[model samples]
Target: MRPTFHLKTLVVAVAAFSVASIASAAGLDRSGQDITTFLQDGLYAEAVYTYIDADVTGNDNAYIGGDNNAYIQGNKTGDVAESYDFFRYGVKADINDTFSVGILYDEPFGAAASYSGDNNFVARGDLDATINAASDGALPNYAQAEGQFDALQQAVADGATLTPQQQAQFQALGSALAIAQAEQATKGEGTNVEVRSESITAILGMKLGENKNFQVYGGPVAQRVRADVKLRGIAYGPATGYTSHISPDQDYGWLAGMSYSKPEIALKAALTYRSEIDHKMQIAEIYPVAEALGINPVQSNTMEMSTPKSVNIDFQTGINPTTIATAKVRWVPWSDFEIVPPLYNEVSKGSYGPDGLALVGYDDDQWQVELGMAKRLTPALALSGTVGWDSGAGDPTTSLGPIDGYYSAGLGAKYNVTENWAVSAGGKYLWFGDAKGQLPTKKIVGDFQDNDGYILGVKLSYQAQQNFN
Candidate 1:
């Protein structure tokens, strides 16, 4: 009974704080591929709910100036992110002692941010100044109009009094100035952005040899993604007043892994690899204001959106009769993830992206490490604690995801209510590393410092055994 009950206690402790442990680990990574579904001993099912909140404070500055965007001007706060909830569900069945199969549902990547307050955190740069720059790029006759207006002004300054001919010329210059003012009206404000991704994975496991001590597993995975970004203040000025939408699209990938275990010592190690999922999605760009500038107002095009590939190495061993030590190292190649819209590439070729780069991308890969321990406190209760660290991909991070790195700690507990039912809960707090907001130009927009985040979660697990004759 003691050995049989230990499985339930372990499931609760592992699944309790799973969401809290990896809510903000890397680029758009909400879950760190914990693979808790494989921890079940037999037919098992689990459900989890998590609530995440983060406080990221930074200031916005005048875009016309060359100073950092985090300068404390008049704005009080730029708390663009909001609190949200997430859920996970899974089921696994052991087909005899040597073979097992399982399925898992989780949200791997997501983003949600909405700027609030009277000030324009949604668009921090100078609107008037950006129009001046945009006019030069989008307006064909802008310089000619300016030169004509200048010559008329010089004539008025030289003459003592205004003649009829000179007055008519002045009227013509006024008309040209009106045209410039109209051009300025075409610019608009950027408001908010929301992006989401969900995944479902099916897996199968087989015993390695006659001893049935080693296992190998592989599976097929599918995911869906949707995103909408309103550019009230485009970092690239000429591309402002644009909204980019990627309707929910499905993509496919695969995962494979092998595990080794020693039952007598309760030691196990597993290595897993997840392939990148590529999406060829149709993008709709709404540029109501862009059309006024003689650019395409409505555009429909297919784009290649690919998520990063990752590898996970997980290990655990019983340190003592009542304690277990566990560790994990995860690597993600985030430098491969890129979002390049058609119109953005067209305008940013010479202006924002000197090397013809993406609208948003990272410069380096990402890595995360976690060390933790679990202990049995009572016959039916177990407790766990963990500490983790993430090496930020780079400094001067994207405004879309401003965190540079993080140091985090978590605590969890599991309680068995009956022979077949168990409940668990946990929470994690992270001290986020600060970095400057960078644009496509690779210039610092502002500095974000001293921000923090937290996640709270609860989970339930049920075990069902079936008899076969």
Candidate 2:
């Protein structure tokens, strides 16, 4: 049977495009004013989609016996993926040649689904034997064979002084029960974690210069960031309880920028930057049955994370009156990024101890480039195409989250319906790179493969000649 696209898939694609559009606009000079003016003056609205995929691999060594003595070997592996879509509409009115005001609404950020299933990492049947042996060897007060024999004797004695044959059967059952209990007390749950974030931003712009070549602007950037984290197939040890839910966090920030152009050379360039925003998240630490399910919620804590800063440069020059070429380069400093929550820190410092803390080391920095050309097919139509590349953040990636880089190609067109009205549409395809990360425990690793995405966008605008006395 042929596969059909779902409505959610379409929405995710559209949202992803919107994010790219916002990033594109945010990186533009003069607070993205030029693009806003171009759109608003034409009385238009825009819709966009953005998508991303990432893979992670890692190994973690389980330390049983209450953070000391006992040790058991285990492994884990998985992938993280997502898609986002956004739609926006706005209008611009010129107060004069030197100024204009506009308002826009768009979904700035959002995330879709993720997966981390258990395969080899879960030692189901033999887990009891392995954990029992490790705990008995490590714990100071543990008595190996003697403790097992004593428990067996007690069970036999309680069975109304069992017959010889029944006594043997009871003894064997007792030993198995003892071992199961020992194992249950020593095994540490392995980690198979995933997380995602989505948000939005809005702003206004102002222009200054005879030819509108220079401009400055700023506005409130409202954002909503949501994260879903899961740690599955865990083995519970004594002294530790686990929780499953981590609530989503939301906050707001602001943006500003400037631009310059030399019309004679048909050359233009601009610089834009966004400030970092913080989130204090409230998360559920542990559940009542966590020990049985191998899930633990760290103690109460605040999750502190922020989106990185970006810089973009755009250049356009006329090849002739009928054709123009444009290019863009963007820089995102992901290396400075960090996730520190009170609960995470406590778990690192307390429970699993130092080894647990090491998993927190992560730094990512990325870059992107784009090139495009627009040709005037006629007085009312213009056609354009662009290709871009986004570099992946860093090596030995983390399962904490995945936002790998990609290769993208896009096509676009602008149609002029009248001297003062115009409409534009564009679509892009992205090929994502694979990603992997190492688990703190031994023999465990996660892998994500074959990541790709797509985007579509539409924009409309109108221009009104201003009157001055």
**Best candidate, lDDT:** 1
| Residues 51-71 of candidate 1: C-alpha lDDT, one tens digit per residue | 888887775444444444434
lDDT scores of the candidates, listed in order: 0.69, 0.47
Candidates in order, TM-scores: namely 0.82, 0.64
Per-residue accuracy of model 2 over 1-469 as CA lDDT, tens digit each = 4233322111111111122332321111111212333222222344333333323333333543334223244454444333344455555555666655555554433333344344223323343443353353332333443465566577656875667875654444343343344333323433333343443445455767666778675666655555443333333222122233447777777667676655554445666676776767765554223222233433555566675556656666556555656677767665666545444444445335663443333455667777777667766777777788777665445444333566778777777677656667777777666554333332123444465666666665554446654
Model 1 lDDT, full chain set: 0.69
Error of 1 at 215 (Å): 0.9
Model 2 per-residue lDDT at 109 = 31
Model 2 residue runs over 4 Å out of place are: 1-45, 49-80, 88-91, 104-113, 116-204, 210-212, 234-250, 262-267, 287-301, 351-361, 400-404, 416-423, 439-444, 459-469
